[model samples]
Structure formats: C-alpha cells, structure tokens
Target chain A: MRAPGGVGRRWAPVLAVLAVLQCFTLLLLGLGQSAHAGDRPRGCGQPLPVAGSAGFANAQAARRTNVNTYGAAAIVEQATASQAYSGDLASRFRSGEGHFRLTFNDTFGAARLLTLCDDRDPGDQQTVMGVDDRDRWLKKDRLYEQPLDLYATNVYVSGGAQAIGGFYSASVTQSVLGYRGAMVAGQVINLYPAFFAPAVGNWQRGDGVASYAVDWVAGGYLDLGAVAARVGTAGANGLFVTVDERAIGLFGTLSRGVGEAQADPLAYLRAGLQGFSLRRFGAPRLSEAIGQSSLFFRDMPVGVDPSGDAELSRLRTLHLDQRAIAQQVEAALSYRVGQQSGLYDVHLGWHTPGFYGERSDLKGSVEAEDEGFGIRVGMIDVAPRYSLGVQGGRYFSARAQLRGEAITGMILFNDPEQLALFPFATNALSLRLVVDLAAGG
Target chain B: MSRSPHRPQRPARPGRLSSRSLSWLTLAAGLGCTQEVAPDRFCQEAATAIAGRTEACTGDLDLADARYAAFYEAYTCVDVPVESMGEDTASPIAPQDRLHCAFAIRNLPCSLVEAYGDDIEQYMTASPICDTLVQPKGGAR
Candidate 1:
C-alpha cells in the first residue's frame, strides 16, 4: 500500500510543469508580427507638425508618471549590496561545522518601490527598510577562542510623483560585516535628481497618448568601503568612489483613451546602462567594485491585478543572500485572453543573469478571475531547485477593495537535507488580508 | 585570544575599461574625424534615413513623424543654414559631426528601438554621437 497522499505529492510537480509548458505554447501561438510598411504619414519635403505648449505639457506628465512608476526597478542597488554581504558570509562560514548561528530579521514596511502607485494610493510616497543581522560563533570552544561573525543588510527606498518640485526617487543599500580585524562594507545609491526631467511630448496615436523621455542619471556606489579599516596592527581607511556621469535612462508609457483612460497605462518600458568610472586614489586596505545594467518591460491589460503582477515579478527577482554579484535582466508580459463574468490571465517571464553568471530561468502563471475572486498558480525554476506556489484571493467591494490572499509553496526538486537546513523553503504558507479605503474610488 | 583561522582574502579588482578613458577616446575621435556637410544636404540625408529606418522598425508613421519634427526643431534643419545655427555657441559641433549624429540616429538598430518606438528619440538625445548635435554653450567637442 502507498503512503497517504504520496501519489498526490509526487504528481504536483508534474502538473505544475505541464501547466507552465501549456502557457508557453499559448504565448508562442499568440505572438504576431506587425506589418505596416506602405504607411507613411507625410512626405520628406513637407514640414512635420509642430508640438504646441499643451502637447509638451501632456508629454511631461506622461514622462513623470513613467518615471515614478518604473524608476526604482531600474536600480539594482539593494540586490548588489546584499550579494556582497552574502558572498562574504558564504566564504567565511560553512554549514554543519559545529558553529552556533543566530539570525534576526525585521522589516518595517513592504518595500514596494518598483511600482510606487500600484500598492498604495497614487502620489503617496512610502519609505521602507529591512535589516537582517546574523552572528555565528564556534560551539566547541564556549569559554574562549570564539570566532565571532556579525553582518547586517540595510535597504532604504523613498520617492514618488508627489515629491517636492519634480518627481524624485532614491534607493540606497549598505552592507557591513566584521570578523575580527577583517571588515568589509559595500554601499549603493541610486538618485534621480529633480532637474533630471527633460522636455517630452506625446506622440499622437489616434486613441492613446504615447510619450518617451530620457533622463540624465548621476549616482555612485561605494564598494567595499573601509574593507579592512582595522586589520592587524596597520589600520587604513578606504573609500571607493564609482561615479557614472554618462549614465542615461529611457522610459516610455503608452495609454489608450484620453482623461479617464489615462488612469491606467497599457504598456510601460524602461532601459538603463550605468558605466562607472572607478577611481582609487587614497591608501586603502581592500575594495570590491560594482556595476549594473538592467532592462524592464511590463505589458498588462487594464482592470487586472497590477499589484499581483508586480509582487510576482519582485518574488522572481528576489535572490535573498544566495545569488552572486551578477548582472540581471528581467521582463514580464501578461495578457488577458478571455473574459466572461471571469477572466483568464496568462503571464510569461524570462530572467537571465547579466554580464557575470550563466543562469537563466523562464516563469509562467495562469490565473482565473471571476466576480472579484481570483486564483493563480505558478512555478519558478532556479537551476537545480524549483518552487511551485498557489495564490487565491477575493475583492469585497469597489471603494473598499478588500483582498484576502494566501500563498503556499514548497521546493519540490531539491535535496531533502538542504530543505531541512532552510526551513523556510519547506512547506511555507502566508496569508494576508489588505483593505484600502483611499480617496477617489 | 586565538585569532580566527579564516582571514577574509582581499577581492581582486575587476578588469574593465575606465569610463574616463572612454570619454577621452570619444572626444579625440570626434576632433580628429570631423566631417563637413552642407546644411541642406545634411537635413535631406538625415530626414530620408530617419524616416526610412524608423518607419521600417516601428511601423508607426505618427512616431516617425514626431521624431522627424523633433529633429528638425532641434537642429533648425527646416530652411535654416548651418552658418546661422550655433553661431553664438563656443565649441559648436563640427558640420561633419552633425551629419554623423544624424547618420547615427538613422543607423540605430531595430532590435534596440523595436520594443518602444519612442525610445528612438531617447537614444537620439542620449547617444554620444547624436547628443553632440545640440551641444550647450562652451561644451566639449
């Protein structure tokens, strides 16, 4: 006789893989190449229409919205800094080495900087930080000769369209760790200056407003700052200034209709390349450098769960303290195929490690939404390990869109001992009910 | 007190081209290979190239139209002579460099600008070759 629920447990992974493959097939079938070669609006000799003041204003507004929405996603400061700390920790400590490990993590608020207006009310600025501190000591020598390890990850994100003057967004992450005389520190700051906004105009698209703008980005990262501030008898403070004056970002948004149609955007895309000038002048102990290049694009139908897609994208890119300092590029495309009283939504995404590593993954999910009730199931493959998760929720009313969602997942194809070591990966469940009563329903 | 056995090793510095040197190289190239083209010829070539390339890539005539209009307005390409433009500005872009900027915009790969048609405009403004077309007063070559 088989063990109770053994068959169901074994079949879950197979079912998840099948569902993802089916979505991929559908996506490929739906892909269509646009053809409009013979269409030319005006002759080369004829002068083009001049954009009026109102046109310029509308374009600026569109630019501001796009910047506030997709700016933070362009910054990889937190991911880069966190990876530095994890790299240092992994190199020093090993699991099951008879070492006592104590860990503490506390997050004040959800870090929803990528899509600022999706979570909260539009124009509401939110600041959040998460701290994870870990300490390890030798268990055998309890009295003396205890090798102490202390490290902390701090992330700070703030900015919105409602910010003073023009729109502003900033993200900073600092990682510091000390093991005896050896100390390492890494900090990344992404700043969008108020004056960075450039003149933009909307391109007349018949029924929608489409605008694109490029902003000059100026920010620097301090990699391995004070790496060995106090090493042995010789102590020398080190500072790494990595400035990228030539950094530039491109943001674009397309929205259908006019006034009310402008409330929801149809497509959003942003791409940025930051080339840093690394200069080492003063006498310093040790330093490690950091650089980033990212491309983000999201196309989703209106009236669907935007926050859900954002959260899903965030979870896909959330590397924790495991991934190395490799370049990362992620893109998500969601489509609503059918709608009756309910809707069928399929999201397809692909993420690849940029510049540094050779690990890439494809993720897909299918969701059914009907009468304010929704359920989604998805899977993400991270090479040797993969996790399958199911999320279900419902909306109560229009003004008060109360949603109670519960997500549960487990690492199906991974080492049992590894799962035991990382308890969070083994059959984890989280439930949250959010109620928003903000103005303007 | 016994010292920890594993002292963290200093990470090796990554081998990457310095941005400062890259900027200098770009400036040197611009100065050494400055080309001179008539204003009318420059405008005609730029308009023809941008219109063909942008239309082929995006299939959106409105976007192509807007880009052409923006480019004309930026360089005063519509019935404006090269002598009158950038007269008061110091270190004006050499006539050949201006044409180079136009060609660069025209030659932008479809793969780079296909995702968003409007991005072509951004590339025109941000690209080192194209940005020199509208240089600020006393700007570097």
Candidate 2:
C-alpha cells in the first residue's frame, strides 16, 4: 500500500509555486493599472495632497518669503484656498482611493494636522522667497516649495517556499509604494510560514503516528533507558521537531519630502500590525511556544490598562500573554550621502515600548558601504544592544552576483531578570549567503 | 584646568595615537575590563563628584540655588538586599561590584561626562570599570 499522505506531500511544492505565480501575476496587473492612473491630474481647485505636517511646514516656510513681495492679501487668499483643498483631500482620503485608505484613514488625517510650527527649511531663504513676478507667484511658489513631484507607483512580490535538506521555510511579501503627494506612502502584506523536519531516523510512521506509539501499543512498554539514548541521538543529528508556525503581517509607511535643497535627508513615520495571529500549533515546550509566538505574533491591546489583573500585569512585563493585535509605530529622521561607488547613511529613531514584542529601544544606526564591501552598526538603548553586520559581494556576470553577510550583536547592558525570562544571548551570530539574479549585478 | 581627586590626571606630554589605534582602544574599553568596589563607597563618591561637576558647569542661578537636588536624589544610595537587585540565578550582579561601578561613574572626568552627555547611562554600563558588575553565580569575579 502507498504511504499515508503521500499525495498531499508530493503536491505541496507544486501548490506553493502556483500560489507564488498567482501573486506575481496579480502584482504585475496592479502595477500596470497604478502607473496609468498616476499621471492623471487632480480635479480642478484640488491642490495635490502633501504627506503629513512636513508638507504644510514647507508651505509655511515658503510663505514667509511671500510676505515681502505678495503682501498680506495674497497670504489671506492662499489660506482660504488651502482650507478648501485640505477639506476635499480629507474627504477623498476617507472615501478610500488606495489600499491604505481603509487602514490608515484616521491616522493619515491626524498625521496631516501634526504640523510643527517651528519646523523651518534651513535652505537659501533668499532664493525661496525671491519671486520677481506677482501675477504667477502662487503657482511658482508651490513649484519651488515641493522637492519631489514625480508620481510613480510600483508593486513588488518576492520570496517563496524553499526546502533545503531538512530545513523548510516559506515567506512571501507584496509591497506597494505609491505617490499621494511629494512623499511616498505604501502598504505591505507579508505571509511567513515556519516548518522544519530533521533528517534523522523516521520519527513518524506511515499512518502519521509518532514512532513512540509503537512502544506504547506493545503492552504499555516503558523504555526509559532507550528514551535517553534516542533523545541524545536526535539532539546530535538535529531533533525530531516540527514547528507549524504561520503569520501574516500588514505594514504602512508615510514619509515627508527631503526638500529641494535637502535632497539626501528624509524624515519618515511607519506603523504596522505586526503578525496578529489567533491560533498556533506544534510547539511542544512552553519556552519554545512562548519564543515562537513572540517572534511573529503580538496580540496585546495597545493603550489600555491591565493593572487590575496581577497575572496580566506580570505577563505583560515578561511579554508573555500577547494575544490581541496592537499597533507598533516608529518615527525616524535620517540623512544619507551617496557617491558613484558607495553611500553612507545614519538614522535616529524611537520605538514604542514593546514594539514588535522586543525592539522597544530608542535606536540609532549608521551604514557605510560600497559595491564590494559594506558594514552597518545599530545601537538600541533598552537592552543596550549593538548590532554589527558585515557584507561582502562578488560579481559573477552582468546579471548574476553572490554575497555573504554576517550579523552579530553585543548586549552591553541588560537587566539580568529580563534576560532570564527572554534569553537574548550576546554571543549569537547569523551568517547568510545570498545569490542575486537581477539586471544590474 | 585645576585637578580634583575624583578626576584622573592627563599626562603632561600626551602621546598621540592614530585614528585606527584610537578606534581599537575604544573597542577594547567597551569590551569591559572591570574592577570591584564596595557599593556604599561608590555611591558616596559618585554623588560628591556629580555635585562638584554641576556646580562648576552651571551658570543658571536657580539651578545653582537648588544645588542640583535632582542629581543628588537619583545618585543617593539606598539600602536593599543584594538578591533584590537581580533575579537571574545563573549570573547576577555582585553587590560590591555594582557599588564600585556606581562610584566610578560618579568620579568620571567632566570632559568625559560632557562628551557622553545624553548617552551617559549607556557609557556608564559599557565602561571598563563597570562592565563586570554582572558576574556568574558565587561572585566568580
């Protein structure tokens, strides 16, 4: 007789490939539609929407220059026009134009109002304010203030199921970046599945029963001595463990333009519903279950008090009982300088407490890299962890390249109590070899 | 600049080091070669050093009048059982070493403190004299 579940096992890889192909086809279709729609001009009297308060701040900064030439009357007229434009934009955003319209409806509107009155463009004020003609000044002013106006939309789908030896993993991501204004905003959907099987002796029978069932069936035989030997061999050869973990995450990002003069530096905000899962399976031990669950799934309610329940409070402190989906937000200000051969960038940011379950630290990162070699260093404050990553690459052909990367972290300062519960070892290192098949290798 | 007991003296002819050497030295220091000190003494010394540095740096009359009350309150030593400080049974901070680290931070030079500025807490833990506060069980250090 055929082995049990053989048909399903044989079809798994084919099904996975089909799914990936379907996703890519949909992504390509979306891209074509978005590209066609992007070029269409806004309705008459509708000022193009800008990203968040940074856009308004740029407008205000430009207005200070207008005061000298156009005078108070022009400012008053502009204000009236701006209010009407904002109201219309807000209504359209609520009506849902893009994928993020439903997700970030309230957030986008709220963020647009977060105008920092003190934010000023530290560029050549004279040139910004200098406008010779009063007749076409408003149109010129708008053009001058905006750093980026090229509206382009793109959708990318990458990664699929892969099985190498005993290791099995599948990850797929669809990212959509579109132009709403001068800044680019988008949403990403990621599906990740974790599955692994050891190459050791068969742990399961043809009928899907564990091998231990045979011992149990034979007159309740208990082999304690043999159990230890089996475990030792399993550990040495890689344990007979299967983790059925799957997570789906949604992410949204909003950014401000770097300004006409400041082309390299950009300030952005990002928020995500990072892996909100309701059910999980296949973890045998409590620690393993907790660790796996914590990695991709977070289900704790945000901005609520759990003080009444002592157990809940304890779990939150240990980051254990997370079963309600919550939002994690990050804001970063970054600057980058690029050359023909290489580029350097630095960023400073803050993450909400318990952000993505663990990375709640105020962080700063610096990366300086070229085509052949690169290095990145990131420092975070909570555990005071310092992540160092080094990458080296070699080009095989015009369309093929190979790269190797090594990443490690050092916990300079840590709370011993916290470390005991969530073991983040400083000695852990990750090595990866990536092969790139692209046009520009 | 006038020197104090809390501040380490710089050599009259300070040896010049290349940028690469300086980077290596900084990395080595960050790796942490620490010395043990009594907690109470460390607290006292740290508080004194901070108070003295604040008085020297501040030009604000109101802050001077307050005599940096906040700094003193934060750095002041409190009596607590060593076990209460950490929950890790495998490796915990030795009470004496923790105290010593505290003292060393309190005695850091004004220049060094100013250089670190907002990142003083991070520097303190990563500092050579304070890094070994957390030691394996039975105070192996």
Candidate 3:
C-alpha cells in the first residue's frame, strides 16, 4: 500500500521545534570549523574480494601453507579501476603489485613488502567543475601520486587456527574543502551533531596497525585490530610543515558458516560481519594550524560556543569522547568451488549509510546530491554488496583464478531533503576482475 | 665387444699464477665487491625531495585584482550555506541554511589559486568565480 503524500506536513511542526533546539545547542557547543573524522578512506571504489566467504578461507590457507616462505612465488595481483576518488580529486586508476614473502623459524613470518601506487589526475575533477582549459589548472604534465598500500607485515606468532601480526604503513590522500555558513555576524556557526558528507580533496595519512585473528574448525573466524594514525593536510602557510592531527580506533570482524563446513575446507557456506569506530584527538590544535596553512588563507573564522556566544578557543581543544567520529558495519556472503566441486556457498550482507555520504553543500546539484537523505542517513542503512569466485592450482604448479561481484542498494547522498530515505537502484553499478598468482609455476 | 672410454692427458701445470696475473685478479675481485650502497640511498633522498616540492605565488596581493574584487562583491556580508566545514564530517545542517561570510574581501585573491597551484582544479570546481554553473540533469530541485 502507498503511504500518504503529506508526510512532510506532519513532520514540519516537529522539525520546526528541532530547528529551535538546534539553535540553542549551537550556542552551548561553540562549534566552529569542523574537520572530517574516520581513519578509513571513503569510496576507494576497489572491488571486494571475489566470493566472499570462500576467498577468506583461501587466503587463510595460503597464509599458512605457502605464504612468506623463502623462494616461494607467494602471491601476486594486478588490478585496475574504472574510476576512483581521493577527497575531491577523481581519476581512472590502475595497479600492478606483488608480495615477496619469506617464512622462517616455523611460525614466524614476514612479507618483505606490500607496495602499490595510485595515480589520478585533477583534470577530470576540473572538467566536472566546468573548466575546459586543462593547462589553466595543471601547471605541468604530471600525475598526483595517491598511495594505495605501501607497508610490510610481520606475523609474530602463527599456529593451526590463529595468528597475530602488526604492520607499519604510510600513505597520503587528499581532503577537499568543505564550506559552511555562519549563524551570527562574523562568526562561523558550527553546531554539535554536525552533519557531514564526504567531499573530494586530499588528506595525507600514515599509521601503524596491529591485528589478531582466530579461526574455528566449523569454518568460522574472528579478527580484531587497532590503528593509531597521524592524519593531516598540506601546509599552505609556506613553512612547508604538515598540519597534523591524531586519531585512534578499534575494529573487529566475525564470520561463521551458515550451514556446515564442507568435507573440503575450501568449500563452505558462510557469512561475515565487520565494524569499526575511530576517534580523532587534538582537534583544536590541528584546526588552528590548518587555518594558518596556505590551504585556508586565514585563521579559522571566529567560532561560537554551544551557548551561542563567541568562543574561538573552543575549536582548538574539543574532547576526544565528544567527537564520536565514524562507525562502520559491513556483512557479505560469498561462494567458491574446487574445479571438481559444485554450488558450495551463498552470501548476503548489508552496510549502513550505504556507500556514499551526501555532500551537504552540493544540495541542489545532481552530480553530488543524495535524494535519499530524509528517509534514513548514515551507517544504519546497509549498502549491500556480493561476490562469486572459483579457484584451481597446486603449490608448485602455480594457481590462477577469476571471480565477479555486484554491489547494490548503496545511497549516494547529495541532496539535503533525502535524509533518512532508502536508496533506490540508480547509476550505482560496478564490475571487477581478480587474478591470483601462486608458487610452483 | 667393450669399448674404452676416451680420456685426455694433460701436461704438468704451474702451482700458482704469475705475480702480474694475481694482481689483476685481486683488482677484478675488488671491483665486483663494490655494491654502491650509497647510490641507492641517494636516489631515495632525491625522489623524496622532488615529491615535497610545491609551487608558490609570486608578487603581492593586489586588492584591485578582478578575482579578489569579485570575491568581496559576492561573499561579503552574504549568508553562505555550510553543509560540512572543516574536518568534522558529522551532523550537518540542511540545505537552504545560509551563513554570512566573516572575511570582508572584495574578490577571491589570485594568490589562492597560485599558492595552491597543485590543487587549482579543485578551486576552479568549487569557486564561484570559476564554476561552470551547469544544472543537475534530473529535476533534483
């Protein structure tokens, strides 16, 4: 049955009341220029691993039997994307990389290197903005170096069903400029419970990650990890020092077989869930430094407190707990088969706020607008993704495999009115190819 | 019938190389061991230096510059809509909400474009002065 068309009519009064309350809270919070939260980059647009559950098992087995061993081919992958975005800059990206692993002393392991370079141009971004002259914006024939992954991993301990490891990886990305208006004269009115959508820009980041995992005999596993990152933007102030901010977070994942672990461990009926929460500290100092950077051309415009009074100082030292940044949850189902096996698995998963968040400033424009916001926004709405894959190879003869995946129901927020709205299928579609090269060949 | 295996006989040889030959051998071994460890380190240093290079604007900010003047004319005393500002990507306001510009500049300074030369494209896209002003395809409004 269709719902009434006048739903907004009833909510109009409630929203009016909220608007009043929002004004009052804006005074108490003394909000000013806010920064983007969350340690994970949004919308890298890389393809998920093929045949979700099965791929996990295959990777785990590879880690145990063939990974990090001296003189072994270990693992190699070649990937490309139709389009990828870092902050505001978007580009067509391609990557070719491999892992040269060395295993020693039985359980101790090390992946000598994990490296990839992401290349994208601001030209497309310029075009989307309507600039026809490439030379006007691009001073030289050059490409921006976007780091995909560049780090090494060490497995300090390993055994039959569990392992622990830590990694030190450093990479850079862009964070775009986000503009807001002021509520009071000469003061930027930033309110608590501030709404944010991802924009295209650069945010350079480097961090250390430590992870632990355990696998059960029933074709299931649990994984946990922590991240401490130094994230910042370019120093526009000419001093050439990065305006740095610190963030820390905890993340975990769990997967179990829905039916049963097949006689062949490679084949399984399984499902998995994953989530993360990240908090940024020292915001007050970072924002001030950024304002001084060449990026802003000036200090953070004056800020107002939650009590509706001018309080420029509040912007610098906001509490860590007060800033509950981003929390993400994801679930996926995947199936795989041995050349000899058949129909071994199935997966279904969902993530909230789906894939893309709305760019609130681009409210009316279609390119960045999300008409689904009014319905339901943020991580509560699961953007569903799925994959199916197959594998064949022996240790020494080398292994080769291929798979395909589809992600549906993701809400790309661009419009202000679409808040809390459910995403309908639109231009959101992607296809991916994965190749694994193993040892022996 | 059995056939005998062929074996070549050699005359007696010297027990050691001549002095001149030995010297040459030692030189060759020394050259082989020279791995050029420092060159690898130097390459890394050079690459990082280049990566860190950025362009800077020359000359002083001229208030009369058209771009700078335009910024003042449009944004000064105007309520600009701020959906998400700064690094905090959290609870944002709805569209149609407009905030006033605190800085009283007449135009967006050309220095901004020059100072952030690498990201000029982003500025062009977002800046009112350089915006293409194309409408959204669907009736999103």
- Model 3: CA > 4 A from native: A1-161, A168-171, A176-411, A414-441, B1-101, B104-141
Candidate 2, residues B1-141, lDDT tens digits: the string is 111112222233357543334334422322111111233433333333333333333322233223333434333343322221223334343333334443454344556645654442343453453434332233333
DockQ metric for all predictions:
0.01, 0.01, 0.01
Per-residue CA lDDT of model 2 for A259-361, tens digit only, reads 3423211112223333333322332243222321222221111110111111110111212223212322222112211111121112122222222222111
Which pairs of residues have clashing backbones in candidate 2?
A299-A323, A299-A324, A300-A324, B39-B99, B46-B106
Per-residue lDDT tens digits for candidate 1, residues A62-85, read 223333232222222222221211
**TM-score of each candidate?**
0.20, 0.19, 0.15
lDDT for A224 (candidate 2): 24
Segments of candidate 2 deviating more than 4 angstroms:
A1-165, A168-441, B1-24, B27-29, B36-141
**Segments of candidate 1 deviating more than 4 angstroms:** A1-70, A76-86, A89-441, B1-24, B27-37, B45-80, B85-141
TM-score of chain B of 1: 0.41
What is the TM-score ranking, best to worst?
1, 2, 3
lDDT for each residue of candidate 1 in B1-141, tens digit (9 for 90 to 100): 222322333333368334334323422221111112233544444544454445546544456566555555545333223322233545454333444544464445677556545543464552364543343233333
